[model samples]
Target chain A: MALATLKNVRFAGMATCVPRRILSNINDCPPSLRSERERLVRNIGIETRRICQEWQCLSDLAYDAANRLIDQLGWKKEDIDGLIVVTQSPDYLIPSTAIILQDRLGLEHTTIAYDVNLGCSGYPFGLHLLGSLIATGSVRKGLLVVGDKSATIKDPLFSDAGTVTALEFRENSNPWFFDLNSDGSGFKAIMLPVGGHRNPVKFFHLIPSEDEHGILHLPTDLILDGTAVLSFSTQRVPPAVEKTLAYANKKIDEIDYFLFHQANKMINETIRKKLRLPEERVPSTLKEFGNTSGASIPVTITARLREKLTEGSKQLLLGGFGIGLSWGTAIIKVEEACLPELIEA
Target chain B: MEEFIEKFQEAVDFQDPVEVTENTVLLDLPEWDSLAALGVIVMFDIEYGKTITGDHLLKSKTIKDLFELTVA
Candidate 1:
């Protein structure tokens, strides 16, 4: 039960940046999946996804999003005390992406900058990380840049984007409640077996091979066991959500919106039904952006509830699960968050 | 057992109306594919409150075998 409430911290604003290229699962299906295109689109709920150009990387998108958010919030880069980047995709194998982003964002050299290796569960976890730091009051403000530009595998299941969530210290603010958990035994449920030190990239890993489903994959590519992942998410997420609500001493109905990590249509829908939340209360970006991995939660908020989040005060319950076999829930208050228009790079 | 069979039919959602019995070799059906497997997995989890893995789905040959795994 990793549950805690961080005080003296509030969300200032957030911005999301996605690649300009849009690839439709229905219109641009590979020959192997062409026959099941309609069925896949219906069940998975990913109509299209944004893909980065060959020259672009995840850091590029994160940098753009951070700049947009900083500019929108009208904050000086030097005032920021910390920068935490959450991404499984890095600009390079060495020296955390946050360091690069720190220099790129023109933040002070004294700022605390680092990266967390996570996917799907990254956003809520990143919030907890930076929120706790800011709660200390020594760290006045910080940027949580989380997202991923998945491998160019030509699968609609993966989309590319980055987001920057700006959080600042404000005494007597509403406490942010969070419950985070991870199961290492199920890490294999979604993994890249190669390219890591455990299994160094080999010649064979570079060559593409067809799986039983006829979808081709390189050994270095992400291998997702849909059945295992679906079962894990459905069973794990609902409990975490309930626990977070209970931890906050808040009821499910009190939350104005439920933002779930946009894994897919089926997984999210199943979790929603288990919690008995109405479809209207749970917003989804899956239909348009597919699964942007860590970026899904913020991207969905920026894409779907931009106006409401920007103009009104609301209670939000966010659930992020999958990858690292991890899951977490957060209950927070958003009051006129300074959200800018979605950026394309 | 009959209830399980009916729900399984609904979950798999074959294009053609196909009669599924306890003895039916589920994987042998033309409509039984990865998507169908996912459907059954979700059904078992949501309806039976049992979490069955991809390995369990592959190891079970007949519909009865799957039902047993769900209840076992």
Candidate 2:
């Protein structure tokens, strides 16, 4: 039997959440004690960092963003029939973060709520999953929440942030097409070394220290092979974009804008150069916020919309890739569901 | 060596002088961070084929200790 065909879905609203704690350049630290790693932060183009206060969790960020989107769109909690929260950081590993969000938001128990453990490629993949569900008549209104706290990794390269995109299922409309893929073999490219099933927490505690370069060092902490990740991103990301465009029977020039995951300044710059996209078409927030994992893309979109860069645009090419060694892309036509201005936070 | 230290200090946004003495306390300097640690590690590994970890630096409180470890 042939597989069932899925219909098109539209994104109606967007919102983002960032912690109040801002680590800016103005913060004082002695120069003679500076480390090489500290220098890398300045060189990498990050200006400020955000961290959730001690009492907050990943769900809090997701809920804040979701509530803001709901408020901006004048959407009732009952209107949302489905919710998908894509995050790698959870308050507890046992119960999914979505269930907690659903209860907190006063969503109906019947609401299809679940969590997808994903990073980097999460925004596009979550969009694809929700779009498929809406198209198949599984639910009418769906909310895709993407966020993560790199604090768990103890890596300053990541910031605490979340984003919510409300998607409305529209009939007879040519919704965007998505191309998704994953290769688990390269999962080690970027990962946290502790706090998992394989490497449970033990008696020994590891803290940050300073190396010869005067940089604070945290060995036995989050270890990322920067070169490996850079090579993977530069190699896999562009092809994913090109293949998706080809599948949609569209050319690079036909794409109005490209919203990619804000992995870093270097990766984004490399991809932009490789794709030969106009500087105006690509949006990035790594310089100010660092990498917010899954929240990067929607946050970028919201930022661009606020800047008036997305006004009057129809075709937008969205791509997100990272972490799972996973990546994907999609193309959507802007409509009323696409709100230009909402929550700026 | 002094020029390298100067560039390193500038790269890490340290306000101190470029002339780093062997006994300078790295932890007392303001430019230390995870990124700076990685940069120093890469620099030492590339220039002198030395690999130092956070634990090693934690044991040594001064620049003289680091130089000794690197040269040894």
Candidate 3:
């Protein structure tokens, strides 16, 4: 007798938030500063950036995206049985962002709401988590919100954005084959030096310094060893993708589209080359928007889906990797979903 | 002396006067938190190579105690 095989899961609806405020790569800084960081920004594959206003928070961006998704699908907030927000940025340091989003969306008290602290790889991980909960009959419908306000870093490398995806449980759906990996050793590759229990903020006084590049340094700022991160991504991501495809009993050629975390233009291109994916099949948003951390992959998917890029695509190999030194990939089929466009009000 | 106090006040975003008379409870200030503790620790560590932990913070109650800890 043959073993029972689960059917493939499908994406239903998607929405993304890109802040109205645009910060151009050259205009944000003076001409003198531009010449120095121009090559760096270009090498990273960022063009224009988006950021939330002074009063807006990560939850606000997420709420907007989720609301858009609900409006487009014509589904009530009560229809969502589970809500998971994958974010490192929260309105408050204590209460989880997911709970805040739940309240903002007017979800019922019975809805499961929680926040998962992740960075770039959050989207795929969030999907896997949602799929598992729904597949087990725990929840019929789920909302996965991946958002980040890397703008708090005050660095040009990060942008503020969010993406919300709606997942519905079908009677018989294909099991979303997921591959998750993490390496705590590389945690320091991307981190904020202050603002955590590991190093309390009260003990330090701020001092300003200028490095050789004249970049200002402060005690409570985000620091990224760019070279180190790039090297790690280029070396680890392709192999991880290959491993995930093998686990799914699929081949690189079998994947209709490859959705990778929009870390940077070069990194994404490098991974695509290593995977031997056709340039046209790889979806990217890093050129227009800088790295939005957890929101990267979903926002790209939402944008592409809105443009009708994958209307009848059969298979998608999605992967996200960065921060936490974490990586996750999954294969799924796209359904005739009502993907929403950003409505300016 | 006043310059150092001003730097400390600006760093922590505390509006308290820049007077270091020695009785001010550093933790009692409204701006005190784990993040602020880290900011102060790194500031003093970079300046004086003195590392202060949460346990060390619990032992010291006043600004003068912190100064003494660092200078000692």
Candidate 4:
């Protein structure tokens, strides 16, 4: 059980950026999916999603969001001592995206910058990683930029978006409790089949292939074993939520909101129902943003509960799971965090 | 078995016109896709409190085979 309580770190604010191009799962669905579009939309719970232009990358969105958040928080670029970029859709395989983002954001040379390869679980995991540095007095302030340009091959299942979370060192702040777990055995549940070091990209991998469903995808594209993911998420997330609450000595009712990674409507609803949480407590970005991968939880917060989170203090229980078959839950208080409105690029 | 058939039909959202039975070849159904498989998995989890994997769904030739997997 990778459970810990980090103290003295305050969530300053967060901002999110999505491309201006929108793809409606209903109106923009391909001909192959046209027949079952309504059923797909209803079950998946994503009516529309933002997509990136060809020139855009995950870093571009993240850069915009980080700039906006820094400006909103009134933080100087020189003061940001740590930069953590978490994503599965990085710009390059050579240099870590964080290094590039550090330069792009014009942060000081003393800032610690790197990247963490993760998908849905990236947000909470990134917080734990960066918050540690802040808590230890090694870094006074840090930026956690998490995003994914997951709209590969124009697949409606994934969306493109970036989010930046600012955390500052504060004295006697409320402790943030987290329960994180991972299962490498279930890595195949959600993954790109090829293009990695183990399965190096080849000419054949670049060729588009058709699955039984008649949807065409390259071998390097994300292949989701829906049944496996559904089972893992529905079973694993509920217990993880319970464990986090227990770790924090908090009860379900004490949580003002439960923000889950907007993987899909069906998977999220299953987890919510298993936990017996009311519909209103669990805010979702699935309808507008679809599955924004790592950025989903914060994206949901900025899109749905901006006014509430920006105005008053709220206890939030966040659940993020999938891709690495990894899942984690964090219990934290949003004390008037500067949650800006969603930005369109 | 009759109850299982009805539950399976509902899980897959098959219309009443398309009758399903114990011997019904599930793969033959036009709606039998990854989404339907996910539905059945969720159905088993919610209704029977059983965990069924994609392999179990793929290997089960008929609705009876699927129900038998839940027999335990």
Say which candidate scores most in DockQ: 4
Query: What lDDT does candidate 3 reach at residue A63?
Result: 80
Task: Looking at model 1, give its docking quality level.
Answer: medium
Report the number of the highest-TM-score candidate.
4
DockQ, every prediction = 0.55, 0.08, 0.01, 0.56
lDDT winner among the candidates? 1
The local lDDT score (0 to 100) that residue A45 gets in candidate 1 is 87
TM-score of 4: 0.95
Candidate 3 reaches a DockQ of: 0.01
Q: Whose DockQ is higher: candidate 2's or candidate 3's?
A: 2
Question: At residue A223, what lDDT does model 4 achieve?
Answer: 80
Clashes by residue pair, model 1 = none
Chain A TM-score for predicted structure 3: 0.92
Q: Which scores greater on DockQ, model 1 or model 2?
A: 1
**A46-82 per-residue lDDT for model 4 (tens digits):** 8888899999999999899999999988899999999
- Which of candidates 3 and 4 is the stronger one according to TM-score? 4
lDDT score for candidate 4 against the true structure: 0.88
Q: Is the docking of candidate 3 incorrect, acceptable, medium or high quality?
A: incorrect
DockQ of candidate 4 relative to the true structure: 0.56
What candidate 2 gets wrong by more than 4 Å, as runs, is: A1-6, A25-30, A33-42, A151-154, A205-220, A307-313, A338-345, B1-72
Stretch of 10 with least lDDT, candidate 1 chain A? A29-38
Query: lDDT per residue, candidate 2, B1-72, as tens digits?
Result: 464565445434543444566667887776565444544544444345555554565677776676666668
What's model 1's lDDT at A283? 94
**Candidate 3: misplaced stretches above 4 Å?**
A1-9, A152-154, A203-205, A210-215, A343-345, B1-72
Which 10 consecutive residues of model 2 chain A have the lowest summed lDDT? A1-10
